[model samples]
Target: MSVTLVLIDACAASPKESRVQGAVQAVPKTAVHRVVVQVNSDDPVIMKHAITNSLNLLKAYGDRNEAAAVEIVAYGAGVNMFREDTSPVKDLLRFLHATHPDVVFSACGNTIAIMERNEGHPLSLVDGARSVPFGVVRLVELQEAGWSYLRP
Candidate 1:
């Protein structure tokens, strides 16, 4: 399997700075706090940390998830996070999805595709887990759009 990678340069301009460079590059701040969390490990403990971190952020905003947009992007071995048959935290996933529309759970489509091909069958994501083209690219896009990045 090809390793997923995200190269974030410290010297690179932020979204705010990019806006000053050109209006077309500007991404408007839609929420007070925008966060994107990355999950690339298959470890259940790591996945739980990501969920807890997201809950903490939302709780800080009085459990008003809309006050802080949060997204969880999973890829690599972490794709198992959304695997319907193998997920260890499906209960929490269901609760969070039912209660928080602002917390988006994204599975990497590329990883899913590779897994399906290798297994010679299709896969099913747990309820409320959606697909993105690529986890690394999703994280990069969110950062570019001024979303705070977190990995747990």
Candidate 2:
């Protein structure tokens, strides 16, 4: 089964715009699929669009009954999505995680450290997330592991 990974690095917006630059990396799925979104900013608009696009992709898989995995990695200013106390979109984030069992979220440890410097404590992650050492490095590893990359 062929697997594809969506490597999201651009701040999310319309699926087309957010997905254009990274289109080359994605492989069509014959058996499995994965989508990884790397967030690098705190802009609500970007995050919202990213969330929507990821959902759209998931729906595509669900409709086809294709086996797939989805992940969201927040790095740099993107770590704000998982901030324990101050995230502006906590409710929606929670909803997405609970509803989507296959979706995993990762927060960059390095970004968390920086966030701590400003907020005074390491940020807690959302319910269904894992924290990683670095976002960019993880993306590279995912690609190397044969998961096609998408920059949406």
Best by TM-score: 1
lDDT, model 1, position 140: 91
lDDT per residue (tens digit) for residues 1-152 in model 1: 22222221111112332221123322223457878899999998888888778767766655443356678899999999999988977876776676665467889999999999999999999987878888898889889877899998
lDDT (Cα atoms) of all candidates against the true structure: 0.74, 0.64
Clashing pairs in 1: none
Relative to the true structure, candidate 1 reaches a TM of 0.78
Q: Per-residue lDDT tens digits of candidate 2, residues 1-152?
A: 22233432222111111121233222233437766776778887677766776777776766667656666777888888777676666766776776664465777877787778987866677677667778888777666766656554
TM-score to true structure, per model: 0.78, 0.73
TM-score of the candidate numbered 2? Answer: 0.73
Clashing residue pairs found in predicted model 2? 7-150
Total residue pair clashes for candidate 1: 0
lDDT of the structure predicted as candidate 2: 0.64
lDDT of 2 at 34: 60
